[model samples]
Target chain A: MNQIDLGMVDWARAQFALTAMYHWIFVPLTLGLSFLCAFYESLYVRTGKEAWKKIAKFWMTLFGINFAIGVATGIILEFEFGTNWSNYSWMVGDIFGAPLAVEGIVAFFLEATFFAVMFFGWNRVSKGFHLFSTWMVAIGSNLSALWILVANGWMQHPVGMIFNPDTARFEMQNFWEVLFSPVAIAKFTHTTSSSFIVGSLFVITVASWYLLKGRNTEMAKKSILVAAVFGLLSTAYAGLTGDESAYVNASTQPMKLAAYEGLYNGKAKADLVAIGILKGQKAPDDDTDPFLFDIKIPGLLSLLANRDAGSFVPGIKDLVYGNAQEKIVGVKAKMERGRMAVADLAAYKNARKSGDKAGSAMALQKFGVNQDYLGYGYFSQPEESIPPVKLTFYSFHLMVTLGCLFTLFFVVFLYLAYKNSLERHRGLLRLGVVSFFLGLLASQAGWVVAEAGRQPWVIQNYLPVHIGTSNIAAGNVQATFFMFLGLFTLLLLAEVKIMLKQINIGPEEV
Target chain B: MPGYSQNNIFFKWQRTVVRFYLDGFRAMTVGKALWKIILIKLFVMFAILKLFFFSDYLHTNFSTDQQRSDHVLEQITLQSKIQAVEDKK
Candidate 1:
């Protein structure tokens, strides 16, 4: 099978991504709302005011709904690792299994056990105990983020372990290094803060919408103010953490960074294209070739790469193939010949196997004639595969669009919050809806770019994606796919309906 | 509590069976769903079963011995040949 088939991996990745994205709609809210709930609770404790209690209770109700959705969505992700990417699981099980186990035992258990008390045992428990439970829930959520990030971080940087060829796994060599890899830290901070930003914007916008609609003024005021504070902090931190994330990416996966920036030429002073197509003659045609006309960031690439503010970063072309002067020009030609020979052999074999005598003769004739041309197909000593440049180019654009929009939306929201006009500005409230959807878009685009950019490699260089299948029959995957697809679709529809119903009803009923 | 020494074997087995069904039903029905914990327990049980029956099949199938390794390489080569023919157009 070709590397980029929209087959089992595609189906599985799409299914898993769908479920995760659906569930993600709730997770950031759970993280963001839980803190808002706690903050309201703290305010209640200090002021001994009934309004604080009302505010806390209102958001807490919303948090409970979100937390339930998050919990449901999260379960699928855990089981999916073993089911969809079984090879990846077995290969990384030695190193990866630890964090997943810890997440379950330490973070998940802590969250779940206390969440029960916080959600339902308010009357049975003391106020202090209940408050403590809420705080525990917050800690539990963040801790969950921590462990998951640690797992993902390893994928990006692949450190703190030694590859064991015997078992084909990476055995954990240093616990501390695994925990504190630069990529892991940068990713974790950036991811969690981004979630917070998403959460804050979500709450504030909804609250502002309510106020604009004349639904609940006091509720809207408190909600908007609290969410605005968190939103501002998260937005500002996202920029800072994003910078760190970029730096880590530049160091760890330079190719990914290059792809994201559309730096096909890999010039030392790589230009960041504001926009461009990655098709036809636009993309780098050969490793030694330069990209076609493109927009660029003067020296932003160098500044982002080294933080030295002046050092030039190599473009994608340069990264994939070294300087043009260093290239072996005739390599591809040789590679082409080997490929064409194989093709001719295959056609001849197919004709013979099918018992088509005339076809066999014709195929042999074609093979004899094309023998000289085979060299063109296989001249390259080591053939360099480019990403589906169009896909990468478009996915990169989608991600950048969302990023820029998010930056603008949050900046505007923050300014409005500072002006104390969040409740009054209908325009800003509308922007919230736009920003929330944009967050979803950004996350999906990010995944597409990252996964697609890694086109041939399931684990970078060592393993190919096609060879890493589960050995289960394709029928098995098909059967399971239909079953889970139905279930996930039902769950997703129900979740959205329920969430909307809760939002419309408001906390007064509870 | 049911005392072990005095009970008949049938009664003991009946109680164990009853408790098993009850625990399973509770896990399915409980509101504060401890489904994950239950799922893990179930996974371990399945793993034990696999160890007994499926482990040998797995070892034989995926083992990277020379013969299997050669077969895989041949398969990949064949597949690539087909791909090249397709790409020609």
Candidate 2:
């Protein structure tokens, strides 16, 4: 077997993160703008407004530019699974590949088919059929999000699968369980709604720019009105879904919840850290006071996590050290069990080799019993399982704060548009324009928390990232990493240039 | 789309879809020929060509699961191997 190389692991991780981050930049906009285009086209169809058609075509052009780049960024991720994390692919591909195949064969094709009609069939097809095509594009894009998120949600909380000792893999046993996972549902709704908020923010920002320049005033005003109402509705839904996400984290990944709060000590009725600054650098898994000055909301963590204000919320120390009252497994114990699980797999294989059916059965049973803690075995020390708290905490807090702030931005923008006084408040219009980055930041921060917070383990409790890297040289991976970085950066630059050029053309020309 | 095989509805739908696909190919014969090239390239690259380059090292070696896993464990826990080599030196 190939040896584990630390440098290879790091390179593979950096590659995945870089590719995924760039891909996300375009995906959210595509998702949000697809629906927005459909909505605008529907209005055009209903009211027979040439202005609405102009707006629809304008944003649709931007959407096509973004979506085209998204397709380029997207395919690499599927290939990366095999190239970088081949073991992980082989381990869970039976279950994981199903979602990817579904996304490609069904959802992607559906989106592409209707997208052609929506974009090129304006004069060729009937108005009603064109509207239907627009809506189909929206539905198809969202459906694609659903399948991808379901696959990811399985990683956060693997279910509906059983291990096969002989094949040394986890195979799908219940497709429904994988499909309708609670975490997946919550993540899908939360993520897409946040994307919608970003989309609305994008529309408002561009429209605000036009309003400021005093060109296409009617289009700008109409676009802002639609985006504000849409943004407000989706942002509200995001809050509700965000709550569900927190609930899932609190229940399944208590350690991650602790990191989110930057808490180090255990306590019932725990105070939520709304704001704080870390005092000094502390060693990993240390039980010392990690914060200097923390403004707290008493029992809010308990409330947010469990919906019961008095319920116990375990801290980093409790999770890493020990907490008898909370029954926290502590990272060390899980590591031990993880070793036993690995050992059992070895024993099962040995027994099978010797034709000892009963011994193989016993070993298989042991593996089944201990497999839940299997990933911990890959870590030499408990501290390795501890993710960077500062990053996770900051990312999560920014996502929440930005989400709340954008809700207010939408309300204020709506009010301005309604009063026909948006032109009077250039400052607010500029802020509305700035909300685009703020919205994207919030969306990306949410991703950082989700991906970075669940550190060490790529598939939550079952698999560590180090164990999944391909059997390739570190230098080779590094070379490929840089190649991808340069390529994606160039692609992103080209996309932005094309988009800016299209926007310069303005709504009337479109 | 659900297949309604109870009343041969599924067969009818399948026929319609197949006809639509054939008509599309006929309309864009050049594109259709290009698609044939694309499909052949895909088959060769993923299915036929992969077998020559992508050898399963884990399966090829370490006959038992124990041997395979131990090799991984040894790889991860490399400090002992380094220490032993240093002692021998």
Candidate 3:
């Protein structure tokens, strides 16, 4: 019942974060560019255009480079589950590990098996088969993303699982619910669409640079036309899914939503912080004012969160303090309930061990009632419940702002490319180049919001991060953390060098 | 491409992967030694080596679920080496 002071927790967290961020750098591009390659290859096959094939081959080479590096990081990412978070590996392994195991066994195998053909089969296989291989690679990669995201979604909003006290882990109760969770569905669409947008931007940026250089003008122009349209459509899709995610977060993690919105008190028809600067002087856990200035859209937050304009939305204070409009339970009460749940589970185990069946049954019944709030049992105080609000608020805003800008950019770029005037507007082309980094930043911020906003909880309302780490020594974890950090950095550098060399080589050379 | 239904896309993809797998295996016969080396290396690393090195700690150290969980809790809740270092500093 007493809290353990595990210093390995921070090192483990840092290592995982390092690997995830590094892995993401390549994964988004791989997810998007695979489709672009397949699309280009499809055109080549249909129209008998050598130019299309050239474009396809060029992007496919880049995709290969990105894919290799993504795989390198991805392997380590999965391994870390066992090495760093062994406790988590067991605690939710039954439910959480299923999708992950499926990702490796099914999706990764599909991608890896077909990848050989996609790359090497060009010389050995027929034209149709090669094209098919390319498409398969794309599908496999996205399918891989789907399974992983499904696992992540379950962590964010744990569903279709029952905690077995005897096993001391959550097990899958309904495979379909786990797979088809609304949170997972929204996350898949949102995340993949953003990756598509990132991919489209990469194409646009590269093509724009080519246009500026007065090289590969035809290829560049055509590529822009394709990428711009795809990007525009993907941007719209990302927006819709993002909206859905917000609703899901409100339902599942209202505190996270409140923090991101900078909502400190309950309000009926809550306004959205449209454009504002959050006052950053206060510690995240401190109860100082959240912002200095703001522009808000009236009732938009309420509408967005609850899908009802007049619905009462609880903010940090209401959620934390138990207001008259206690639409949400305060952290204190939840922790108390969680403590009861924890004690009951412990008692049930103790009673069962001693062959006291009646006592075990009573304990089990009590635990079942409070099991949902069990994660809060680990927290020593109400203040521990609050996530880093300032970071969440800003990251949410920055992601949204950048996303909106990129969507607008894509719209204009697509129109210009459609009319074959994309090159004429040099300024807009330069902007297109800039939007590549903007798109990347937005994606990163989205990730930060998703990860950091759900702080303290590795599995929201189920497990806390500090308790979920492997029982490794902090020194050992720290040492490996540095080792992986160094190795991954070198790999990233190598990736960049190889990519540049390949880019300079150009499609004509290939 | 735009009008391709989701189901069709998935089916087409599945078919392509299966075909590729078959074709790849057939093609591998020509480079039999290379395929053998790759598969062997993979098997050794993932299957053989993993069995020796990555023993499941919870399973090995504890028999009952309660003991396993209690150990994890104790490890996490107890002041760690890093914390001791920090305290010394």
- Report the number of the highest-DockQ candidate: 3
**Local accuracy of candidate 1 as per-residue lDDT tens digits, A66-136:** 66545545655655555555556666777877887888887657786687667665455677887888889
TM-score of 1: 0.73
Cα lDDT tens digits for candidate 2, A1-510: 344666778888988898898889988998898889988998999999988999998888788777766664565676667666766766776888888789887675788778667766777679999999999998899888888999999998899998776765678999999999888998899999999998999999899988889989999999999989999999999999999999999987877888888877867798988888876597645567788888899998899999999988887777776777778778889878988887887787778879999999999899889988877776676777778899999899899989988889999999989988899999998897788888888999999999888886788887778776666677866866776687678667767776777777787666
Clash numbers, per candidate? 20, 0, 3
lDDT of 1 by residue, B17-44 (tens): 5664455345432223334433443454
Q: Which lDDT tens digits does candidate 3 get at residues A331-426?
A: 889989987877787788778879999999999999999999888777776766778888888999999998888888888988888888877899
lDDT of 2 at A238: 97
Give the DockQ of candidate 2: 0.08
Question: Cα deviation of A283 in candidate 3 (Å)?
Answer: 8.0
- Tell me the interface RMSD of every candidate, in Å: 9.9, 6.9, 6.4
Question: lDDT per residue, candidate 2, B1-89, as tens digits?
Answer: 46656468778878865665565455541233334444543554446433443335455545776565555434433434223323433
lDDT of 3 at A466: 76
Give per-residue lDDT, candidate 2, residue A262.
89
Error of 1 at A288 (Å): 12
Residue A172 Cα positional deviation in candidate 2, in Å, after optimal superposition: 1.0
TM-score of 2: 0.87
